[model samples]
Target chain A: DTAVSQTPKYLVTQMGNDKSIKCEQNLGHDTMYWYKQDSKKFLKIMFSYNNKELIINETVPNRFSPKSPDKAHLNLHINSLELGDSAVYFCASSKTGWSSEKLFFGSGTQLSVL
Target chain B: AQSVTQLDSHVSVSEGTPVLLRCNYSSSYSPSLFWYVQHPNKGLQLLLKYTSAATLVKGINGFEAEFKKSETSFHLTKPSAHMSDAAEYFCVVSVGTGTASKLTFGTGTRLQVTL
Candidate 1:
């Protein structure tokens, strides 16, 4: 079974469009995170949720918001997506909120904003 | 705060040759370090992690890393290289306290192993 899974492995959308990426983890982890991999392949954390509560919020634009309905799911919604938003988004989860815990990552979703 | 730097952006090696990917880190407190491998179009996979454990930590796929506090380094090494080992490797560090803790990833190093 895939421990961490994200839907729509490839997404192509036009500028100013709204899109959402769904993520689910069956690892029974309490902490989930959203990371963005830019064109340079530099991964940066965007948001983190522990037990359905937002714990960490980076300097991401207000157009992007993460919603966690429960401990098992964390979804990212992007509003008025711009060309710069074209990048791979990864979903990850860990056993706890501790940084020492190893993370399980999904295959990643490639979003292209034309 | 904590951060990790991967010295080499790309490294090429021949089969059976030794492999070394350099990494340096800076942190205000004791840190947790990790090495992750990412094959093309795949998710990142944990190779090994060091969390106040032995200085020499061994991981799967015949990979290992040594944590040197004085040098502030956790470099991944392998005695022999296999073609299948070609991938992008990332050095990561996690620091801070409580639930506020966060992980910082290096730019990544692409490894090319030839037969």
Candidate 2:
């Protein structure tokens, strides 16, 4: 079975629009994370949730919000998306808390804001 | 602070040739090192990891890595190269002291296997 999956593999929207990307993991993991990869391919952590509890919130803008309905699902919602927000978003999960170094990442959602 | 550096940005090798990808890392405390591979338009896959266990680690696709603490290096090697091995490789380092350890990834190395 697919360990981790993300919806909306490609998203193209206009500026000032709002969008959401959903992620699910069946690895029975407790920690989930969202990372953004820019055009330069620099991967940066945006948010992390452990057991549906927020753990790490990076220096992302206030418009980007991460919601975890449960341990198996973590979704990202962006409000007033701008051109700079165009990038690939990846969702990952780990077995335990931050102590575990191995992470299973999803295919990623490519967002393009025109 | 923790960081990872990949020595080569791009490497090209012929089929059945030996492959080497060098990686160096620095950390304040006990660090966990990992090698991840990402195919075009795909997610990252864990090749191997070293976490205070055996210094020599073996992973899928006949890939292995050696961790030398004295040299502060974790270099990946393969006996033979395959066309399917063409992808981008990343070296990652993590220092988990609390409940929220974050990963720091290297710039990445692109491997090109030619026939």
- lDDT by residue for model 1 over B5-64, one digit each (tens)? 999999999999999999999999999999999999999999999999799999989999
lDDT of 2 by residue, B18-101 (tens): 999999999988889999999999999999888888999999999999999999999999999999999999989988665598
lDDT of each: 0.96, 0.93
- RMSD to the native, candidate 2? 1.1
Stretches of candidate 1 exceeding 4 Å from the true structure: none
**What is the lDDT for B15 in model 2?**
95
Clashes of 2: 0
Residue A78 alpha-carbon offset, candidate 2, angstroms: 0.7
Candidate 2 Cα errors over 4 Å, as ranges: none
Show pairs that collide, candidate 1: none
**Model number with the top TM-score:** 1
lDDT of 1 by residue, A28-112 (tens): 9999999999988899999999999999999999999999999999999999999999999999999987978889999999999
